[model samples]
Target: MPLPTTLVWLPETVSTDEEAFLLAAHFLGESLDGLSLSRDPLGKPYPARQGHSIPCLHISNTHDGGQRLLLAAKHENLVGVGLDMVYLPRMRSPYKNRAYLHRLAARFMAHVEFERFQRAAQQDDEEALRRRVAAHFSLMEAASKALGTGLKIGAFMGHSASLPLSALGALQIEPWVQLFFDDLAKTRLVTLKAQRWEAYWGSDDTYLISAVFLFGNEQSKQALQLDYP
Candidate 1:
């Protein structure tokens, strides 16, 4: 069967990451009604029942400053899904410092990504550059999570080194991502709508959250249908 097309979002009300995860699980259990939840050896959550092979319902959650987001899906065979969220920093924030940004790029981004960030920083507004970098990192984190390898050992790590930014660029399309699932974990570029909500500091803030759904043995170009605003 095709992967689940529905993507649900819960409001931000939790104080910590653990609380956010619990809220997401609660929402998922309620959404599925009778489905029971279980965790694998690695701590990934899924739906399960007795006398039958448990169907894989990939779940990923992220939180920042009391805001939480979750992405979930049930893929027919077995597929991996990942989710990540980030707070978009304002231009006056620490992230806007070139040195700090470069440090992050060196630590987590590939050469190509660093170049892209440099170019964007030179030509675009600080806010735009921040969003671009945050979005890229979120996607990379999501893909890594989907592979159950995290960033340290997944596609972000290339040839026993950090994965190249060009590799991530190649995954901007569904087919390429699917083809390189073993390495890239099916990460594709999709519309990420910025969300605005009141922060714990009693001020309005913006966030950028992303998800990578559908990584598996099968090769398909189909992209998940996500509706967010």
Candidate 2:
């Protein structure tokens, strides 16, 4: 019945996350005084001011060399939300070249997952393989961003050895199946270490994008010593 709210920050117009945040505030007609910019221990952006009158805001931003700077905000203190946009061309070699993808998968993906990739490569489904690999990394990066850990969890690379047996279920998706809508876009809920993570990922002709989020207390909270006035 109503039009969906839309916000687009053209790459030429916005270059940094902080600027993007301010642009969003302006777009919503909210005053600078009402919400101040802030970042957490991990240097992720969020709103510093909060209370009954002021809103609690959380933000996450990502960009790749002259590409788009994306930020996400939520009124709820839902752990954190992370989003990333990657220019597929920048990931070219691995996308178009099976040899490159294999080398990459061997070093980054889980052993079984890599085997799946090998099987897919053998089938000569280059485009599907390309999108799947791109979506996979994008999703993982988004998850790490949401967790405020960056890629220290190693994203998808070398994770086969470190992940728990149950966590490996996240990799069970068959290679031939499109991970995205019509094999181009998708929303995935993942369970790991007894916790759930929310993610949406897709790729088009030009770019790969993903957004990941962890809900309140879904994962154990780290103790923070906040000082009060």
Candidate 3:
């Protein structure tokens, strides 16, 4: 089955806000020369096309030198689109810090949720482990912000309604990443299709980086399947 979708994971080579923007524009079928994007006077990225309609779509996410770009069309419309990306390593400082673990757990937990996560971490449950891995998706909040609607409106928790960030400990944030994405997939604002990608660099392999691309829609399963590889 061919699904309607397009996604790209940016490696460290194209490392910069400008490069990230261009890559995203490319996914959504926009030329860098055609659109003028500047850090708005208000510090937001707005299209230079003031009076013209910007299609109520287009988004980008960048973190730790990686970017995820998604290109999607409206529900069979083929015009509307949106995208998002994030870098995984930047969200936490120095892996395996006990204090950092406690701090994140406290911030993410909602009483009962926190305790369950703690038990999972303590018991070494595989399911709990994955949820903890997805905690890295917390950075998606910032990715969503880059997409247009800041974190205030697009909560990462909302994206990953199943596995909350606060539930897991400091091992990994992949679970939250998965959940956050699932949430976006369910939204009507823009039919979203996303992909997860990763890369490694440095002699010591100091970076464990991942990114997500949320596009407009995958009218066909063929395109959507591309998300896996």
Candidate with maximal lDDT = 2
194-227, model 2: which lDDT tens digit per residue?
1334556766788877766455433423222111
Error of 1 at 62 (Å): 1.3
Q: After superposition, how far is residue 214 of candidate 1 from its true place, in Å?
A: 2.6
Candidate with the larger TM-score of 2 and 3: 2
Task: Estimate the TM-score for candidate 1.
Answer: 0.60
lDDT of 3 by residue, 1-229 (tens): 2223334556667665556655656666665565555553224454444434354433334344433433322122223222333233443455635445656655654454455556657755443333343343333333343333333222432332223333321222323322222333224223322332221111112233333333344432223222211
The 10 consecutive residues of candidate 1 with the worst lDDT sum are: 194-203
CA RMSD (A), model 1 = 9.5
lDDT of the structure predicted as candidate 1: 0.48
Tell me which of candidates 1 and 2 scores higher on lDDT: 2
Candidate 2 accuracy as TM-score: 0.64
Q: What is the C-alpha RMSD of each candidate to the true structure, in Å?
A: 9.5, 10.2, 9.2
**What is candidate 3's TM-score against the reference?**
0.43
Alpha carbon lDDT of each predicted model: 0.48, 0.51, 0.38
